[model samples]
Target: MNEANNHVFDTTTGEEQHLSKRNGSSNGTSKNGVANKIPSISEIKAAIPNHCFKSTIKQSMYYVFKDIILIIALYCFGHWVLQCNSIILKTALSPVYWFLQGTLLFAVFVLGHDCNHGSFSSYALLNDCLGTVLHSFVMTPYYPWKISHRHHHNNTGNMDKDEIFYPIRKKDNNKNSFALFFGLGFGWLAYLWRGFGPRQMNHWIPRHAIFAKHVVGCILSIGVVGIWVGILGYYVQLMGMVSLVYHYMIPVFICGCYIVMVTFLHHSDINLPWYSDDNWDSVKGKLSSVDRDYGIFHDVIHTIGTHQVHHLFPIIPHYNLREATTHFRKAFPQLVHINDKSIFPAFTEMFFKYSSQCIVENDAKIHYYK
Candidate 1:
C-alpha cells in the first residue's frame, strides 16, 4: 500500500471514512465533530485481493443458466394457472403467480442492466444481443435505455443533469411537491406517452426517432397478445387483461415506487453531501453514493446493497460487489447502511426528509439540507 493507505479510518460511530489527496479534502467531520479521513482509490483497491476483480468465464455462464431456469419456471407456472377452467382456482393462484412472474421480470431487468455494463458476458456483442432480447420482452427500448442509463451513472448525484431521478433543490421544492402527488397516481402513463408527445421533440429525445427501432418490437409484442386473444376468446382475453392488470401492471407500479423511494432515500440523506461541478471529481462522485442493508432481498436480487461499489465500478459483476464492498468498508467506515429497520422508517421519513431538500455548501463544508 502507498502512503495514501495510511489515511483510512473508522469513525467512532462505526461509519467508514476514506480520505484521498486527489479530492483535496483531508478529512470529513462527523456530526459529533470528530474528523475522519477518507481512503485513496489505490488503498481501496489494495485492500481487496487481485482475484476479486477478475471475472471468470465460468461465473458468467452460471448466471445465464440460472436466469434461463428461473424464467422457464415462472412462465410454465403462469401458463398452468391461466389454462385452468375453474375460476376459484385461477383466482386463488393469481396473486402467487403474478408475484412469481414479477420476480422473473426483475431478474430480466437485472440481466439487461448487467449486459448494458458488459458484465453479463465476456463478449460485448453477446452481451448486447442478450440484453436487447431481455429488455424488449419487458417493453423497454434497449439502446435508448442503455444510453440514458450511462448518463445516469456518469452524473449520479448532480442536481441538474443526472439523467433521471435527480432530487429537487430548495428553490425547486414547491414545483416538485405538486409533481410528486401527480406522479404517484399516473407517472408511468406519462412516461410512456411522453415518447409520442411534443416533449420528445426536445433535446433529450429526438422528434422523428421517437421509438424508431423499438417500433417493430412494440408492434410485435402487441401482435403476440392479439394472437393470444384470438385463441382464448373475449372472456379469456378479459381474464388475461385482468391478470396483466393485477400481476404485471400493479407490481411494476410497486417496483417503480420502490425504485424512486429507495433512490431518494439513498442519496438524499441529511448527512450525505452533493457537489457542484467544480467540487466534484470521479472519486468524490463515487463517494456521493450511499450503501443500504437490504436484508435477504440483497442476496436474491443480487448485491444491490453494495451500491457504492456498483457506482465505483459499474462494469463489475453483481457477484463481486459484496467482496468489493467489504474491502471498501475496511477503508472507509462512514459508508451508510440502510437496512429493513432503516427502510421501514423511511416511509414516513421520506415525506418530511426529501420534500424540500437540496445540495448546499457552507463554510467550505458540503451538506444536504432543506
Candidate 2:
C-alpha cells in the first residue's frame, strides 16, 4: 500500500466521465408489446457461430499472463510514484496511481468471472485453480458465487426466479429504499458482507451455525484471503498502517466498488426488460443486458463492457468478446442493445430507474423498469 495516498471514493456523485457515447438502443415499450413469440434457447445459440464457443489453453494462458503482468506493473508504478520527495507531487500523482491500480484489478475480476463460467480455459482444473487464485486476491468466494451466478443465468428475466434484481409490482417496490440503489456504485461492499445482486444467498454473510450450501468452500476462500491479508500485515508492520491503507486497502476496496458499478450499469437500467412465464425468451433474456463503454479502461477491464454478447454466450473468452460481439450484432441487430454513452447518462438512467421507476406496473406485460 502507498502511504502517500489515503481515502475512499465518493460514488454518490458517481463516475460520469467513465461512460462512453453509444449509437443505438433496444426500445420495446409495453404499449408496443414484445415479440409475438419468444425464441427458443437452441435458436439463440444457433445465431452465434460455433467458433465463438471454443477455448484453448494457450490463448487463455496468454490473457492470464497479460492481466497478471499488468496488475503487477501498476502496483510497481504506484510504489515508485509514492517515493517522490515533494508533497505536492505525492498528493497529486498518488491518487492517479491508486485509481489505475484499482482499475487494473477490475480487469482481474473479469478473468475470475471467465473462470467462474469455465470460459477462461479448456481444462476444468486449470480454471478452478486460476479462479481460486484470482478470486482470493479480491476476496470473493469462488464456489458460492459460481453456483448462485448459475441461478442468475438459468432464470434471467423471470420476475420470480431471477436471484437478484428481481422486480416486484410497482406497488410492491420499496420506494423509500435508499440502500437498494446505493449499490449502483458502492454496492460491492454491502454485497461482500450482506449478499446482494443475483446471488442465491439472502444474506451476504452466511450463518455458520446452520447448514450453509458452500460452507467448506466459503471457509476455504476466507482462509485463502486471510493469507493475502497476512501479506498486507507484513507491509503494515514494515511501513506502519498508513502505507498499507493507501497503497492496498483503500485502492482494493475501490476495485471491488468498480466491479459492482460495472455489473450494476449493465443489468440495472431503464430500457432493459424482465419477463415472466410465456413472456420470457432465452434470446430476449440475454439481450436484456446493456453494454456500455468505459473509454480507455475498456481494455484495462478486459472488455467486460461487451456484456450483452457475453451473456448470450458465456463460453466466449474475455479476450475474444469484442470480436464476438461484432458478429453478434451483425447476426441479430434487433436483439442487440448498446449504450456506449458516458457514465453521466448511465447515472441518470440508474437514478431514474431506482428513484421514480421503482417497480413494474400493469404498464408492460413484459415487466420492464418503469
Top lDDT prediction, candidate number: 2
TM-score of each: 0.70, 0.82
lDDT of each: 0.55, 0.66
Off by over 4 Å in 2: 1-33, 169-176, 179-186, 197-213, 361-365
lDDT of 1 at 6: 30
Please give the TM-score that candidate 2 achieves against the real structure: 0.82
Reference-based lDDT, residue 337, model 2: 53
Q: Give per-candidate clash totals.
A: 13, 12
Minimum summed lDDT over a 10-residue window in model 1 is located at: 195-204
- Pick the TM-score winner: 2
Worst 10 residues of 2 by lDDT: 1-10
**lDDT score, candidate 1:** 0.55
